[model samples]
Target: MEPASHGLRESATFDRATIHAIQRAAETGIYDIRGWGAKRRLPHFDDLLLLGASMSRYPLEGYRERCDTDVVLGTRHAKHPLRLSTPVTIAGMSFGALSAQAKEALGRGASEAGTSTTTGDGGMTPEERGHSKHLVYQYLPSRYGMNPDDLRAADAIEVVLGQGAKPGGGGMLLGQKITERVAGMRTLPVGIDQRSACRHPDWTGPDDLAIKILELREITDWEKPIYVKVGATRTYYDVKLAVHAGADVVVVDGMQGGTAATQDVFIEHVGIPTLAALPQAVRALQELGVHREVQLIVSGGIRGGADMAKALALGADAVAIGTAALIALGDNHPKYDAEYRRLGSAAGYFDDYQDGRDPAGISTQDEELAARLDPVDAGRRLANFLRVMTMEAQTLARACGKAHLLHLEPEDLVALTIESAAMARVPLAGTNWIPGAGL
Candidate 1:
């Protein structure tokens, strides 16, 4: 017989973490608020594998063949669309949530990579704007730090309807992170927790959104591309609606997307996975006869070149990265392991970004900690990472006999799992069956 201790195992349904969370909630009388995205395992790009060229198709010579990775976004209605050398763009990280130095590093890196970086919730920063060659200004519900002059200054405008981390939910920046500068920019009281509005104050639905987009276009002189960003839920319908609203580009963010701070329940339970959302958004665009015309940018859980290739193969025009970008900028670095442990978290496991005590200095506003990160050095690291990701994506594209990354199709992929096959709309490996294709 097994030992009594061995026989008394933890319940998989009510695990240790779950039990602790329940206890914590009961004691605090409040839901847990944390940074980052869902930690639960979900079907992602990892479950899909690229089908390299063989007898049916010829392969491109890696040394000789040229695989174009360049992508142009927002050409549908904007006078000046972004012509990027690479398809990987940096997702938004707000000024309040990140140090100015970190924002500068992001700008430097994106500019070096010949891509764009976005201005998140708290509005544009001079450091970011100065360093970034192409900047996308995010217009959120809070209208924090909003100014018409800055709108005109930006290369593009992104109307954020939702985020992948907590769709249909507002964001929160704990009082600890709300410094005087942050308070001034957001027009909120210092040392007080702030919550962003879930919905746009002026817009109710698609009709109202259309007017808002028009207003933005008029404000920006139609020179900037207007991107409508929505969290991955009812993505097919949302994509269609965004297009109908005269958006030049549509950004669909998946559940794996990160956030500054939000309730753990909302982050884990609210949105759809990126893999599942991509196909729906693509289908909507195809059905509307604007698959490539409207330009689709997918975000959330995009880590490397393989992920980017998989997204493109599934019909995304480009990819956006957030958490991964922060890592490149020196977040969770092993060198900060001791500091992280002191904060009651370990390096690579730290998600308390809302605490404003990041040892890496990328996510906090503490002057001394922020100074620890050298923007130039961090920017170089990010640029290098971006370059590597682009190269890997190009290599995969070439392997699939594609002359351009954009030419990758669903046929170039095979799923390792039935769930992935169903979600990605790709066939299972060694089989012609797609689990839900018939339905």
Candidate 2:
């Protein structure tokens, strides 16, 4: 007899109490960070602490400091300027992963907050394009739902080299969520696992990609701003090549960014983190003498104001958010905790985004499930969150004595932890600091 199965040790090493802890059980589902694991918790903007102005430095006021967050992304060459009131933007997430209502909500919020929202793996939808004031059309490797009309409709175009979630691998539209609509849009069979091509079907390398970008610009009459987005691998080289290839902007997504649906192994195993990639991308752009000329948008794990400020100070022209926006739109609400557990997962822990069974209704395509979410309410909440993030970012910029948020520099920062120092490129607090170049 097995010594009468004493407490939480149903899984050995873990005691019965540990097994009973809902948070512990949900570890595999959520709260797991890429690269780091159960051991290291990501410090929020509130955590890891802040060091205010001292004898050496002077502080600025919350209200008195001039915090100009205005950004003109593609004014150098484009016929139209990609002007934004805030430095925060929205990352691309799929139509299949989210209902049409959700996409519309993102557009409404981003537009209201003076930022841009991206189209996803699926092609441009009329709702998204119509609602978004500054819409970006994503030319993905998969090319799902892509057409000439969308290319014309977009304010900007992003040629996707890779996504941070599964850098080299293509994505799968699982059988469960592959409805007739999604199937027809992708030109694939229904109720089957649809695999998107990993590499682009047409061109192979940088030289060929340059021609392709030109072809697109010509096709669009050189009116739209063309961007190139790549996962954070070989970023220094990729950023240089993307600029050479004639990108007006470069969107670099880091490993911690969320995906609509991807393999668990892929989500956890691949790519460099955002903290490691931002500096290299900036260094590359600086080397090319186009650091701010060709804008750089950094995505992945951008939660609050400090992250936005830190990313900008390190060289990102703008920051994009995905998971955090979903949270603002009522994801993981305790109101659905009972229903979430009924699905064998709790609200905060549920990340099975593939099956279209989300209780919060943010990530599902089912009629009843999608209806659970009201787009108007969700959009308002997201707009409010965007406002708060912008406000906080401005506050921090002011505190650092910077006239504008774009004026924030590494000199204004001091890292509380070793990781923060390396990631933020700031000196350690209370000491003479050194920086590491990850090679």
Candidate 3:
């Protein structure tokens, strides 16, 4: 009390976390690297509120009216485009970064929820494929575990150029998590650190990307949809280019997206937020006259039904979730609080997925740790979460007077902050002023 009265205050530029970071760096020459998405606050979906139908508008009855959530992706090309019952799909999280049981659980849950799950960086696993009704195989720059048979076996293919957490940067998998099985799947030496390439080896630009898309189509006999996934940087130009590159679906991942391992600096400063990126992608798609036709699947920091509804209102065909999915799978259960404490992290704060010491067994490859998670139970939990999220979205959509989830539009939203108003291109709350309109 005496110190406060005397005007003793901490500097905003050098806060407690900043001071600790500086000290940590001084002690160790190497920079700190950890798992998870950006920790810093940014303008996000939470800043936007849905406008419920009132005097001038009419909202649907929650109990009697129907709000359709079904979405058809990859309709632009492919013999069989996916028809999902819900617009919320599971995002890519690689086998190497997650246990086999975890991957299987994700597959089972997504299938049960009538949505698609993706095979991330390290290729397809039988556990995932056997359970998932619809799976998208990721064609990553690393080419880890890539196979023609797996490609053909998948329901669709995603050509990943970058992810949101570390745009223009490579991925990192610590040596500790790279066991014999992980090494075999990725064709890497056992117990050696793995680093993914930032760019594809064969392609340099969109022109080359077109050629690659053609090759992928030929490989699958054009039966599967080809998706081009990119981080949310230069999104407008990127979306336009992806369409021209013959992509049937475009996936934009924002900076808030999770990762297994990457530099802290990269996670915080590399990319734009999801709120800013979605509008740009939609604008680009609209300008090209393929907004709904091409299908835009957005990812990064998407959490609840409100976030889903907000994304839909801003013009996304669907939204994908990764971190929330893992959480639903019990990645940070309070039952493991003691174990988390031992790891110098709390149950809700554990994000060092690269350490291979997860108590919940969702992120580790260790035999004993991985055994702790029952795939069936975890799958059920995830399914429940997915169902709840869908219901929430439906509730919001109904309030917005939307007959279907896709019927949500920008006019139904208002931003809480000027930053959010600018980022989302929505009017500020209590006013009709958009922060950057006509600029």
Candidate 4:
């Protein structure tokens, strides 16, 4: 069955020729196994930060002076608009992968911060729904826990096309974290690893996706905003399509985005980075005249005030956080170095959320491990982080001579690195690359 490997090999840019040999070795049980992006370190948002105003710039009062973070997400094309009191929101992480307490904590934190929380591949949980003032029901391809009642109760509905960690990939839930409760939610056989299909069951392209949006809107009787969430890969085209499909809001998630559990290969090898994605999403919105009409929420490795400010400057109306929130809830602290090392990962670098062995206790289904986390405290930390992000974003906005966070412009940015500059399409500090210098 392996006859044609001799001729076409010359012209092939990439070939599956090595896979045959590799699979055989893997079949004999692995040794020093590593996955994509597993061995290589990529530039994260934390690698660079923003510099605030100086003599030529004015600062905004953190405690007072009206820094409005309010955003109306669905007004552009929705009968019942989705409103947020702040620009920072929570990205979806499944309840099973993250203990119920963690999901509740996220809800509590977002509520305290005056924003929204999203459901993951699994359906809505009463605890999360009750705590989150604004709950977005996710309609992922898996259709797990999906019910009409949940959809009816949602403040909005998000049709998930792709996520940042694995843009064109599927969702994964490791067997260890698949508790009975989780199993029931996903309707899968107990103790088996589950993978969600990447493609939607009903649609293929954006045009079909638009119809799906319309159908959902009609199903809800136009009472809720319809949103489209796509990974950062093709934000420009996807955002434009989401708007054309009558989406009231488009959320762009970047590669650095978090997941409960995925193969290291999927996490690192796939998707565009958030820094590169925000601008593309904004451009799409602007071209469609829905830049602010419909809203844009960006996520991926967003950790602090600097990231939030940078995202807003790049033209996002709002932002979402995942890993950072977990950190706020006490993930990867040095105290857990011993436990992390036991799992073959360092304390500050663990990403195996599906193992049911999170040292921080925020991402485990094991009762004892889950109990180690205090939701009340974690929620408070998340709120504080959100406040700081707001403060920083406001400060940057004022320094740029803008009165509101939404007014922060690309003109205020100078690339910290060449790759960032090229990908973001911005100029170096002293370059003519920025045609609109100070708009």
lDDT of 4 by residue, 1-439 (tens): 4446655343253345346436846886532222112223454444334545678776665556666767878787667776777788888887887889898899899889888889998788888998998888999998999998899999999999988888888887778878899899889888898888889998888889878888888789888988889998878888888888888889999888887766655776788788778878887888877678888889887877778877887788888898888888888889999999999888777767777888778888888988888888888888888888888777766666567777777766777566776666667556646434355
lDDT of each: 0.94, 0.79, 0.94, 0.79
lDDT of 3 at 176: 91
What tens digits encode model 1's per-residue C-alpha lDDT throughout 1-439? 5555678777899998999999998999988877888999999999999999999998898968999999999999999999999999999889989999999999999999999999999999999999999999999999999999999999999999999999999878889889999999999999999898999999899999999999999888899999999999999999999999999999999999999888899999999999999999999999999999999999999999999999999999999999999999999999999999999899989998889999999889889999999999999999999999999999999999999999999999999999999999999999999998979
Q: Write the number of the candidate with greater TM-score, choosing between 3 and 4.
A: 3
**lDDT tens digits, residues 274-299, model 3?**
99999999999999999999999999
Give me candidate 2's TM-score against the actual structure.
0.88
TM-score of each: 0.98, 0.88, 0.98, 0.87
List pairs with backbone clashes in candidate 1.
Answer: none
- Candidate 2 local accuracy as lDDT? 0.79
Clash tally for model 2? 5
Cα TM-score of candidate 1: 0.98
Worst 10 residues of 4 by lDDT: 31-40
Ten residues in a row with the worst lDDT in model 1?
A: 1-10
- TM-score preference between candidates 1 and 4, better one: 1
